[model samples]
Target: MPCAPTLAHYWLAETLRLREALWGPLEDSGEVRRARAQGQGFGQKVLLRAQFLGQREKLDLLIARWTRGARLALLGMLAAAILAGAATAVGALGDGSRSVNVLLALTAMLGLNALAFLFWLLSFAVRSAGSGTWLGELWLWLTRKLARGPDAALAPRALVEVLSRNNALRWILGGISHGLWAAALLSMLLSLLAVLSARRYGFNWETTLLSADTFVSLTAFLGWLPSLLGFAIPPEAVVRASNGLQALPETAQALWSSWLIGCVATYGLLPRMLCLVLSLLMARRNLAAIGLDENLPGYAELRGRLAPPSEKAGIDGPDTPGFQAHFRPRAPAPHDQTQPLLAGIELAPDTPWPPAGLPAGVADLGIIDSRLERKNLLERFQRQPPGQLLMVCDAQQTPDRGTIALLAELAGLAGQAHIALHGQAGAGFSDARAAAWQERLAAAGFLPGQLHAGLAPALAWLAAGQPARPIAKDAHVQP
Candidate 1:
C-alpha cells in the first residue's frame, strides 16, 4: 500500500535498526563474548548473540535496531530513481504521448522493479546460505577464499536451536522485511508510472499517485488483516476446519471461500517456514566454512612427553631385546586389557606362514610386501576376504612371476584368498590375462569391492581404519 519502494525503505531501515539495537549493545558489552564462544562459526555467533539480546532487554533494543535501519532508506530511494529513469526512457522510445507512451513507461518500470526484486531475493539467499547469521562468512564462501570440510554430514543442531529460540517474533520481523522489499519495488514502479503519465499523456500526477496509493493501501490492509488472523489463529483449528470441509459437498461459494482460506494460510505460514529453513542451512554452511567439522586435538600439553630419551636409557632401542636391559617394564594393572600383543615369527617354505612362523596368541602381525606380491594378493583377494592380513606384494597393474608366486603362497595359506592389484586401468597385464584372472576368481566366488582410484582418498580411508565387516556390509558403502 505504501508502494513497494517506500515499504522496502521502511523494512531495510528497520532491519538495520534491529541489528544495531539488539546486537550493537551486546557487542558493546561483554554479553556477546559468551554467545560468541558457544558458536563454531559467524552464523552461530549471530544467533547466539540474538538469543542473548532477547533475554536482557526488549524495547530499547528494538528502537535502536530501527534507528540503524533508517540508513537503508537511501538505497531504496536509489532503486526508485533507477525505476523512474527506465520509465522515462521507455516513454521516449514509444511514440511519445500520442499513443500508449505512458503505459509503456509503466510497463518498463514494472520490468525494472521485477529485475531489482530478483537480485534482492538472490542476495538474500546467498547471504543467509551459511550456518550462522554472520553474513560476512557466507560472502567468503561465495568467493571461495575458504575451503570448508564436507557440508553433507554437518550437524543441524546449531540451526535448529536458533530457529526454535524466538521463531514467532523472528518470522514476523522477517515477513515485514520481505514485505518492505516488495513494497519498495511496487512504490518505485507506481511512482514512475504516475510521473510518466503526467508528462506524456497530460494526466494529473497528484490524482494518479493519490488514487494508486489508496488502492494499494487498501489491498495491503486486506492482505495484512487476513495474514495476521491466520497467523494468530491456532494452527490446529485451521487444520480441523480444513479437514471437516473435506466431507462436505462443495458449492462454488464454499470452494472459493476455502481457497481463500488456503491462500491466507499459505502466505501466513510460508514466511516462517522459509526463515527457519534458511537459518538452518546458513548455519550448517557456516559451520563447515569455519572448520567446525574437523577433529580438533585435545587441550592437554604433551610436548614434554614427546622428548627423546635422555641419559637414563642404556641401549637406545629399549623396546627390543638388544635395548631391553636399559628399561624396566612398569607394573601393569591386573584388569588392564591394553597390553601390546607379543609375537615371534619364523618363515619356512615347508610349513605355512601362519602356523609355522607366527607365535601362538599373537594379537596381530605387521607385514611389508614387495610390489609384485602386493599386486598378486590384491588380485586374488579382490572380492573375497584374504583370510589373514595377506600382504599383497605385486603391482596390481604389472603382475610379475614373483608377485604370482606370493599370491600362490597366500592362496595356499588361505583357501579363499584373492589378488588385490594396484596398476593403471589397462597397463600392467594383457587384457586377456586380466579377464581370465577375473573370470577364474568369479568362478571361485571371490570378487573385488571398490578399488583405489587415486592414491589420496584410498590412503585416507585405509588410514582411518577398515570396516569391521566386509565392505558390502559396511554402512559407509552405498547399496
Candidate 2:
C-alpha cells in the first residue's frame, strides 16, 4: 500500500482541482511553467502547482479538522445506538411482570432490524439506492455541523465527489450502517442476558383472535431454529398451559427463557455481524480503486496548458564550449540614497510596458531587446549608477546563458539590484520558471530574495529605499 503522505497529497491535489471548478481558479504561481518544463503528468502538475501556491498546507489542515469531527460523530452515534438497544431490551421484557409476552418481546428485539435489513437487500435492485444510506447521511450531516468554518464544506464535498466518481461511496456508507446496526444488536443481546439472569420470569402468549392451539404451533415454529442450535424448547403442554394466568414449572420456565435468548442471538445479532463483515470487505475493495477522474472540468482545462503539443526538434547550431562568466564579489553600493530605475530585458511585445503607477523620480529604461540597447544600458549604468535597479524579465521565456551574463554585468554597477519575472500581459508567471531564473541568477552572484515572480513586490522593494527583505520563496505578486 502507498504511504499516508502520498495518499494525502493526491487527495489535496484533487480537492484543489474540484475547488477550482466550484469556486474559481487560484492565482498562478508559476507552477504550470515549471511542470511543463519538467514534463510532468497532469496529476503531478496539479500537485506541483498546489504546493507552489501554498494551498496544500491549508487543505491538509482542513482534512485534519474533518477527520477529528468524523471521529467524534462516530462516538456519538455509537452511544446513541447502545442506549437505543438497552431501551428496547428493557421495554420488551418488563420489570418482573406477571408473564412475559413472548411475541411482543421477539418483535421489539428484531422487528425494526428485520425491516431495515430487508430494505438493504432490496436496495441492490434499485439504481439510486446506492447513493447513500440513512445512517451514513446522518453521520455526514453531524460531522459537518461539528466542523464549523468557511472551508469546512469543501473537504466533505470533495471526499463525496471523489468516492462517488469511483462508485465507492455506497459501499463505504453501507459498511458504516451495518457496523452501527451490529453494535446496536450486540448491545441488545448483552442487555437481555443481564436482565434475564437477575430475575426469574415466565414467558407466555395471549390473544383475543388466535386460539391456544395456534399459539402453541407458533411457539414451536419459532423455537425450531433455536432448537437445532442446542437451545431447549418447551413441550406443547407447557405452551398451551402458559396461555392462562397460571405460571409453568421451573423446567418449563428455563426452556422458554433459553428459547428467547437463542432467537435474539440467531435472528437479530448474527445477521448484523455477518453483514458488517461483508460490507467492510466490499468497502475496502472499492476504496482501493479510488482515483481522480481526468474528465472533470478542472482537469480538462489544464490539458492544453500543462501538456501542449510537442514541437519538432532540430540542431539550432553546432556544439561549442559553454559560455561561463566569472565575477569578483564587490562591496555593497550606497543605492539607498540614489534614484531607483526600472527596466525590462527581451520582454514580449504584448507585455504591458512602463508599468503604470511608477514611483516619483524613478527612471524607466523601457524594453531592452537588442545588443545596442544592452550596450547603452550597461554603459549608462556604469557612468551613473542608480540607487536601486529593478530588472523585469519575461517568465514565459527560458533563461539562457546570454540573459544571465547581461543581468550579472548590470547588477555589478547598480547600488541595489533585484529581478522581477513577469508573465505575458494579463497572465501570471510560472513558479517553476521563476525558480529557474532564481537559480541561474544566484550562480551569477545575485543574493537570495532578489528574485520576484510578480511586478508589484519587486516594485515595492525598489521603492522602499532600504535593503531588500527576505520575501517568501513561493510568494507571488498580483498584477
Candidate 1, 265-342: lDDT as tens digits: 343334434654654555444433331111112101111112213313222212222111110112333333331221
Clash numbers, per candidate:
55, 3
| Cα shift from native, residue 198, model 1 (Å) | 3.7
Task: Give lDDT tens digits, candidate 2, residues 1-479.
Answer: 12222545556666676666665665341345444544347766655665543342266788778988898899899899999998999889989866888888999889998988887787887877353366877887788788777767877777777677666777777777877888888899899889989988878888999998898788889888888888777888898888857868888888888888889888888887897788788777877776656677777776766675753333322222223322223455654437678999899888888987777788888999887787678767655766678999887777877677677667756666888877743344555665677777776667776777568778888888555554455654345
Best by TM-score: 2
Q: Scored by Cα lDDT, where does model 1 land?
A: 0.33
lDDT of 1 at 460: 33
Candidate 2 whole-model C-alpha lDDT, 0 to 1:
0.73
